[model samples]
Target: FTPLLLENTQAYEAGKTGTEIPNVVHGVGVFSVIGGSGSTLGLIIAVLIFGKVQAERTVIGISIAPGLFEINEPVIFGIPIVMNPVYMLPFIAGPTILAAVSYILMDTGIIERVCLSAPWVTPPILYQFLATGGGIKAAVFTAIEIVGLTILWLPFVMISNKQNVSEE
Candidate 1:
């Protein structure tokens, strides 16, 4: 259902003719991809740097490739983010915050609103570029989103680090 974020991009356009939104609407399709995969990559790096748990490592290994293409099932299901309390907050909050930032950026004209609908399978930075009709600002915004999401994922990752070390 995450791919639905990339669907119906044009619905954001206030004017039907132009590729640009001209004005913000429902923030529909404003984000190129959901933040899950980005957070997953961030989690992977966080685990590698600070986590000692082999279980975390295994899940991270399983998640890396799919996370690249914006697929997050391995991380979501493997980490069991569905019902796990430790991972849930950041998992939900990071994307919500990023979406707000994205909406602000586009609304303020710092980044162009999405003009074209990119396939959900498109990679992160590249997806932003294509979604914005080759705008570098969108790509830059996506890079920033990745970094911020990574930071948001850190405390939770460190929690895992501590939890794992304790159980050992």
Candidate 2:
């Protein structure tokens, strides 16, 4: 993920502008599997903090630790976001919106391009800082992404909780 985007940005930034690739790569990391591919960390937080469903809360509780390490398999499969239609919209939309926003910020020079390479499991805020070579702006942008994702996921979580309650 980082390599392709990083290479494109580096090439474009190095005065080799032939293709239409923009000098924006770090944004990929901003939205990548942080808290899981769909930004499930936000979803997890939503469940734990505001979700009324006991089962959902338990799933989130069990998944939170792995989520912190950027592992979302449990939440993804456990919360069943993988095929559940209820969570489909926010699951896709959250990361897409965050990526678009992050890209715009980076393109406009609000945040720096990611020049450093870090492992995918580096965690969220810390990953941004290390990937951008200690740029605080990257970390801040990551924080914004997290907040944005949280907001995006909140509605779906509430809806799911409501459905669960009515069914019970």
Clashes of 2: 0
Lowest summed lDDT window (length 10), candidate 2: 14-23
Models 1 onward score TM values of: 0.80, 0.84
For model 2, the superposed segments whose C-alpha errors exceed 4 Å read 1-22
Residue-wise C-alpha lDDT for candidate 1, range 67-152, written one tens digit per residue? 87778888888866778788888876766677777777777778766667677677778887887767798888788777776777
Candidate 1 stretches with Cα past 4 Å from truth are 1-20, 23-39
The lDDT of model 1 is 0.67
Residue 43 shift from truth in candidate 2, angstroms: 0.2
| TM-score, cand. 1 | 0.80
What lDDT tens digits, residue by residue, belong to model 2 across residues 1-168? 657667755765565432234547545655555687888989988888799988788888899888987899998898789889999998888778777777777677677666557777878899878766576887887888777778888999989988897765
Model 2 misses residue 2 by how many Å? Answer: 6.4
